[model samples]
Target chain A: MKRKQVLVRIFSLLVMLSMLAACTPAAAPTAAPAAEQPAAAEPFEIAVVVKITGIPWFNVVETGVDRAAKELGVNAYQTGPAQADPAQQVKIVEDLIAKGVDAIAVVPNDAKALEPAFQKAKEKGIIVITHESPDQVGTDYDFELIDNVKFGQHAWDQLVKHMGDTGEYAIFVGGLTVPLHNFWADTGIEYAKTKYPNLKLVTERIPCGEDQELARQKTLELIKAYPDLKGIVGFGSLGPIGAAQALKEKGLTDKIAVVGTVIPSQAAPYLKEGSMKEGLLWNPADAGYGMVWLAKYLLEGNKITDGMEIPGMGKATLDGTLVKLDLIMDINAENAESLGF
Target chain B: MKTLLRRHEAYVLLIIIVVSIIITAVNPSFFSLENLFDLLKSMSLMGVFAIGMLFVLISGGIDLSFTAIATVSGYAVALALLRYGDSLNIFVIFLLAGAIGILLGAFNAAIIYFFRIPSIITTIATSNVFYGILTVLSEGKWLYGFPTWFGDFANIRLFTLYSPAGNPYGLSIVTVIWLALVLLAWFILRYTVLGRSIYAMGGSPSSAERAGFNLLRLNLFVYAFIGLMAGFGSVIQALLVQTVAPNSLVGKEMDVIAAVVLGGASLAGGTGSIMGTVLGVALITLLGNGLTLMHVPSQWYDVVIGLVILVSVGVSAYRMRKNIQRRVITETA
Candidate 1:
């Protein structure tokens, strides 16, 4: 009976410990006043949530958050799910709500999956600003670093310039259901058909699942299947890096032109060696900085309007609570070093 | 011959060869020496983890924390590299990682052994704790800009072969380490007393204790050894990717678990071999590579893998039952 009691005590203790561990927020709450108070007196406590943590792309985003926090005099910190899972992201937001954060900024893994959490944050009167996910419901504003259509067209233009407006090209997205990636692919393909009539898509946009290894494997298979494939466009951050590696290994660096969205630091070697001709991405740090800037803007009782210049991101146009900024940087050999992830 | 054919390892090897032939038929490039080396190199990281997991499985325990342990240990090495930069030796980095792994592994072993908690439940809970602590500490950051020597480690080739299409393929240093580890594990399992004790414990703990084996010490050693391997695997993974992304390796536990199971390791414990685990890793690597080459949609990949595992396990279980029935009948006669 004594042993049983001891075991039960230990079991409950274990359960308590685990609960405490799970509920521990990624970023400790800073002592700042609530969002309801007009803030000239205390720093605004804003939480920036990302899709996943510990990758170069999001690392850069955190740097921006730090810079914005220092410059804007806001208590801003970035946190996200350890992996790209929306449910985990929701739990983080719920914890933030309980902690009474002034505002929340996010780069959601799934826009719809995060809807309920965003709704709850808004209901709690926390200002919510999201980046990279425009279709997200229940956010104060959704921002895009580049217009999705124009971004696709930019990729198409690069492909045409390299392939000389002819021959076979392939498209790789993170996944079919990843709205942003598929948007780029669909727009690029449609633009290519009307503009570069001779250019052919080798396959329906193949999903690489945002994995570098999968992207490399798919690129290798595409090369074998289409032998004369002239170019490749990767829509996800890892897609271009993987495609470039595969082409380089196959000794087809000169034969195929690889263009995609990738971190400049990760793509520097390939960009220098000419395996990857170009990379397209808005500075993630800029987006991170902008998200916090906007959150603070709304908190201070400022209304967003078209043609209003915002710090870090210049001249944003408001379209039904979505802020669109055309700030995509084209990364090439000469500019790759300067771009910095 | 019949006995050899009936062996689980034989079945796994057959699946590997059959898959290879089919892939080669569809895409002749898959048959090249370069592709073969690429497949092996790709399997090397998972192969290391599988070997570690094989020990856990054979000892009548499950460890869901291997990937978490790997990430934590690997992150330590990455931070150490960044801190010391050119002043740090690669050997010291690996040593530090291994030490961290052992400590974490010992923690898991102690709790499970003392509290008598089912290993799977304890590990699942511990994995979350370890990962949670890591995330909080690192805040989901990545470590990049390693020394050039470390960056080049993954690509260090001993011998090179050119495919007909002129792609250069080579046996990487990482692959050499993986192969060496496999040999070492096979040696330990086949010849060491601790290895014998592990088998005994898996078969029946009471019997193992009656035979005068120290259960407490053996449990500690087995879990610690797995931790050491997780650390080693993490370093290999970091080198392969050339960047340490904290969250990148967490969900890969499924792949490692699947490889061990497919290699003929029974989850119920007491049955597994290093050769079987290696074959299993090779088969999985080949399946992914072959399917990609065949242009099978990425979405279908998971479904296909699930079916393959189910079918293989089903067949193996059937054979095991039939052999048991035969033994019972023969004994009565």
Candidate 2:
């Protein structure tokens, strides 16, 4: 009986140890910096909030945030709600404000919903930085990975190459209300209308890029509804992969070409299989790294100038509280494996 | 056939049929054979997992941890497959997932049974713990690229059908598994002694104990089964999407809960049917899939889902009243 009790106790001890080990990664980066900060002034507590956590896009962003934190010797960390919900984000920001972080960087799930939270953060004298959310209120500055309009036009250019600049094509965004995605859709459609007059948008913009299953279902429905759909430009990271999978399932890989922003590894198989023609993206890690660096730069009371070469990001152009950088990545079958997630 | 009309699930089915007709009128291709088969594949995940939730709801409790269980089990299996998957059969993978699910479900059950706290609050707390631990361990990374054979299960089909345009489609293996689970749950609830005891316990825990029912065993059974369902669901989701994303499944709990309640399951317990749960899931899936096919604006999606959940809760409340009134009539007679 004593031995059985001992065994059970040992089992629980092991479980507790593993949980501690699991938490160490998230806590270690912040904890170690604090312990060593006696000789130096207090490090900045910068938190870069993304739209959602645990997806490939933001996971990559977290890595970049870590890299910048280590390089700059700042108490920088990244967090967001598990899923993209504005209310959860507001709650997270409220907690951060309550804790009195030095700066709060956000990639909004819903920009307008976050206005009140950002305003609260600003009132608390917290430095506010944002990425992928342009024209958002209550931010000191918004940094963009690429020109949204140009990014859209680039996707259309790739689609035009594969699809011969003509036929009934469709557009898809991360969500109908996702600001950057809609901007891309609008600019891409406009560019296509002027350049490729024969090309047609067969349907209204679909909001399927955020969830793979929804994207797959919508793509299947699209096929059944419009069998002649020759090209598709998807705006979200998961969109093209979903479209590619659907086309592959129906043995229409050669018939329909898909292009969008996708994690390379996820798109590699689809790219090799010929279902997805191209995936255009900027390294999200770079965006995360750049957001942190920019926040530090502003907090140090530095005035920004146009055409400044920012580390982790390239040469930048200023657009009145928005930092625009050019670092677009064109991922194809051959190089998809090399462009790490 | 005549008595079937009295079933609450029958009305949900009728609603689905009516909705289908309306959608088909606007988009002629909405009624196509290919779309139906695609939907059969699409709705399989929610339909299968909601059955697990159905038992809990019927037992006068709720379990919100199923999605977290699914995510963890799915991630675990994905990691396992990455290490040594070529030798493992698909069924063995399912077993691994279910075992993991059962352990977690037992965790939720143990808390609720020992503390006697409301199952909703307990499950909700446990779900956060489960998902938080998962995020830390996974470091929020999505694992892909199992052995080539791993992809084969998703392609397995009972039969292939060609649409009018000569495009081939099939009812997926995921749908087949869901149907099999449906039958198993129906048989248990319809014919087994354990099933009746569950109903009794849900009606009144004290009354059930006095009548010699084992509350511990029943609690263990229902919670473990929900976890088991989550385990199978994780594998099914990976098969369909061909990727395992940790955060994708957890926030989708409301749709399943809404569907089961809509299908005629009373939250107050003492009643629920596998048939009703299935019809409820169908109604939810039809709205999502049909709206997409008909090209309704995407922002309207959430509003419709919210309305379904609201209407279902209303139905459950009204049914409780009707149930009480019938009991009074019986007592007087």
Candidate 3:
């Protein structure tokens, strides 16, 4: 019985090996939707691993990947773990590496945790592209849909637009330890300090954006404690939603403004109702499309350039494996639906 | 004074008043009617979770899986409602969530009962399983865009009172459900035979078995009740926030457990009260609100909270050891 079990395991291993070889770079792509122009080039395989699958944010990313595949005529697809955990994300990356895809793109759940996996992928000669994570170890390049500094500056710009240089505002990041959120908070606060000197920050950053409930509760207290407050900057996707809910509950919806990273659909009702004036975010779809396109460009043996255009993501300026795009979207009540989830 | 000091509820209440006074001194708006109403609303969801934990603690059993059960059941209900709940009553939706929670709780109960394992270990294991299954099913998705009627149902309020600033605030549905659950939980613990049995079990499971209780049936009832409350809390939570982020609720068990334990509930079981639990939760919420209002640096807030919990629990424990009467009896089997 033990010998038979060993034989079964060996058989499965052989099958998996054959499957991997069939899908590896330069060996697949006939299934691609017919493109407008079919150039004579072997279709390279690219895989984009998101933070998690089946989420509205990443669902939009999937569409961008498919569109890039159809247009660029590459065997590009998207996959990720069901949950947003570094361990799960790392496993998916390892699997993609084992499958020997020509390129791999990731929006890491935890950039540090993926360091070893990215290093392994690099050793295998796979071109690695990352979105929302820069300065990551062992990566071909890291790209952002929007310049980080400007994204933060733009958030303050929205706040100042509504509050007219502001009376007082507070910032809420997802957490104090979240690097991206803190970076945005720092830049936004700095922009407000110089550009709109009258715009006062009521306090240092409050870390509660990841939890809608905590954000709402904190916003309630912020309003009560600082009656002079005029605006709030929410530096996480759920941050704006929770702040808006607190404002609506207080009937201060029209009195105070909230603007920052927000899911357009989640923030739409509030925007229409005047709890928030504007929400600033980059489309995840653009990030998804841009990364895959960059991966294909590199797999074709083109060295990274200073000012190359990433498809659908505008022009990219390179900075030592860190790419930045001057792309940002301002979602208001009038145009939220058009952005797509 | 000594009698009053002996009661845990009075002790918690005193701490709350002290905290409130300090906060009001720092930010006069802390005393504002609008802020008071808002605080009440915010406490409701955590209030429900703590009540369930209180029961579990009093029964000498620990449940680390309520948060997982709550999120999974709540997310499922939200998705189902969005897909096929046009004419269904909102109350029925909440009930469905509770039923799902009970089923999840039953899994914990079955394992602990059959294997005769410690509940803490069993629930810790179940917490991961429940969360894993939920993550797989939901893919960490957030369910939004409820039907118009659903939003309307969520917005139902007891009454709206305008603050001096013309800002409206009052009792919201979340608070109302929490208040109802509190009263129901209080009754079950205060007036039922099953309630007495639970206390007995916590005090000594062997003694409880000797006292004519059906151990299996009692275990099932106790765990199922925790499930029931978890389910209800999840619905109220999702309704208040207007979205279901499947992953948000799991890591919050620590705070809930902290509140329950802070209320003078013994980790070893057999001693606690509803009033103490309520006051304990209020103190925690007050500090949270007060710190943010005082503009204390965010990084230092957790340190302050940890210190406060340790100090408060420490003081009570020391006082009990010194001032309270104790009868120690130990014997060979």
Give the alpha carbon lDDT tens digit for every residue of A121-186 in model 1: 878999999887767788999978888889999999988877779899988887766668877888
By lDDT, rank the candidates, best first: 2, 1, 3
lDDT of 2 by residue, A1-341 (tens): 22243345335434544553343223312112133345568888898877877778887898888899899978788887665667667777787898888899999878898898888888888999888888788788899989877898999999999987879888889987688898888888899888999898887898889888878888887887677889889988888988988888888888889999899988899899898998899999998899899988887888889999897466899998988998888999999999877
- Residue-by-residue lDDT tens digits, candidate 1, B1-333: 135323899999888888889988887877877777877877888999998899998897878788889989989999988888788777887898899999999999999899999787777778778877787688667776688788666677898877666667789788998999999999998899888789889767778899898888988988888999999998988777667767667778778878988888766666788888998898888887787677676667778888888888779767876776777799989
Of candidates 3 and 1, the better by TM-score:
1
Query: Which residue pairs show backbone clashes in model 3?
Result: none
The order by descending DockQ is 1, 3, 2
**Model 2, stretches more than 4 Å misplaced?**
A1-36, A120-125, B1-5, B308-333
Q: Write the residue-wise lDDT of candidate 3 on A220-336 in tens digits.
A: 888887888899999877888889988887778777889888889888888898888899888877877888888988887888788886655567788888888887889999987
Among residues 3 or more apart in sequence or in different chains, the pairs in candidate 2 whose N, CA or C atoms overlap within 3 Å are none
Every candidate's DockQ is 0.34, 0.23, 0.25
> Evaluated with TM-score, which candidate comes out highest?
2
RMSD for each model, in Å, please? 5.2, 7.3, 9.1
Best by DockQ: 1
Between candidates 1 and 2, the one scoring higher on TM-score is 2
> Candidate 1 overall Cα lDDT vs. reference?
0.81
lDDT of 2 at B100: 99
Candidates in order, TM-scores: namely 0.87, 0.90, 0.85
Comparing 1 with 3 on lDDT, the higher-scoring candidate is: 1
Q: Residue-pair clashes per candidate, as listed?
A: 2, 0, 0
